[model samples]
Target chain A: DAGITQSPRHKVTETGTPVTLRCHQTENHRYMYWYRQDPGHGLRLIHYSYGVKDTDKGEVSDGYSVSRSKTEDFLLTLESATSSQTSVYFCAIRPDRRNTEAFFGQGTRLTVV
Target chain B: AQSVAQPEDQVNVAEGNPLTVKCTYSVSGNPYLFWYVQYPNRGLQFLLKYITGDNLVKGSYGFEAEFNKSQTSFHLKKPSALVSDSALYFCAVRDIGIPGGYQKVTFGIGTKLQVIP
Candidate 1:
């Protein structure tokens, strides 16, 4: 209930198709991140944005891309989805403080066939 | 690199019994630790955090975590386990002094706690 919402809560698509997940936050937090959660991998950061148009790669950034054109919206896109990319995606936001807690969205469950 | 580890994959406890979900962390400098819980198909919800000060940090839903620097651990504890407490728990850490203005929280694989009736 952090005013964070992830769209397309469930998605299923074929491999080689494009997929996009959207995260919207009303808190106006300075940092936003996209993460994927697998059975044994926990939650791995794929990409993050500190500000509008300022993006950076995370530990598992390969085959994933992110964009933040405004403070409230962050988008994660997979140019060509793969079966390996099938996982539950979460979006998180943190205020501009060193030890501030991060808030998470409900999560998007994506499956690639 | 900053990291967190939850040693147990699952923990089982009967209602009214004391319960613990262990977590340990590694970081070069002082680390900010946190605990979060996730219900099935839901997002991770903040439980507690250890930023500084006291070693015993109390969090939401009758849960607390003790930060033991020497032991490199922040184990979560609850005096009594409730059936509702059954959920997946995650521990996370971040270096307090990491530069470049990005604070990435590294999470543990998560431990599933089942409180039986």
Candidate 2:
């Protein structure tokens, strides 16, 4: 459970339109990540934040942006939606300790028409 | 760069039979490996992890994984399969070898396990 929640569990937006997905966590973990899940490709990391206002790009960060202005929220933004951007997005958080595993939110399904 | 590979796309086993899902990893230094299972339309659930210590790590739901440093592998296994065990399994890795701080985790493409009745 890990006290994580992903808002807009399901969404559909027009191509070339702006979209944003939100991830909120109550555990107060220092690390949060955004990933997209696609068939065969598995989960691809889009971006991550190690601390409030500190962020970094991931393997599939192109065409996507993220902001973590506060410790509890990490936002993923699609500058201009594309059909290729349609997928199930997951948000994860892990403790600062090195030995522990990350906890995941339910997930957000976004479709770009 | 750290990476994980799940060589199988799918595996099937009859109920009560032993099952295994393979995973291998590449890291510049030491590694911290993990296994996760996902049911349809659900988020990933942690099964087990290989941090430090024993090579054979056990976790939730009758799952265990063997970590072999020489082969660069961490394969998940269960003694007996249950129909309820059918799901998508993911193997993930984090490179502790990376200096400075903890690195990001990389997950495998996933292996679908079908436990037939």
TM-score of chain A of 1: 0.98
Question: Model 1, range A27-110, lDDT digits (tens) per residue?
Answer: 999899999999988999999999999999999999998889999999999999999999999999988767788899999999
Q: In angstroms, how far off is B5's CA in candidate 2? A: 1.3
For residue B5, give model 1's deviation from the true position in Å. Answer: 1.1
True contacts kept of each: 0.73, 0.63
In candidate 1, position A56 carries an lDDT of 94
**If scored against the real structure, what TM-score would every candidate get?**
0.98, 0.96
- Candidate with top TM-score is 1
What DockQ do you compute for every candidate structure?
A: 0.82, 0.72
* Tens-digit lDDT string for candidate 1 (B1-117): 888889899999999999999999999999999999999999999999999999999999999999999999999999999999999999999998787657778999999999999
Among all candidates shown, the one with the greatest lDDT: 1
Pairs that collide, model 1: none
Off by over 4 Å in 1: none
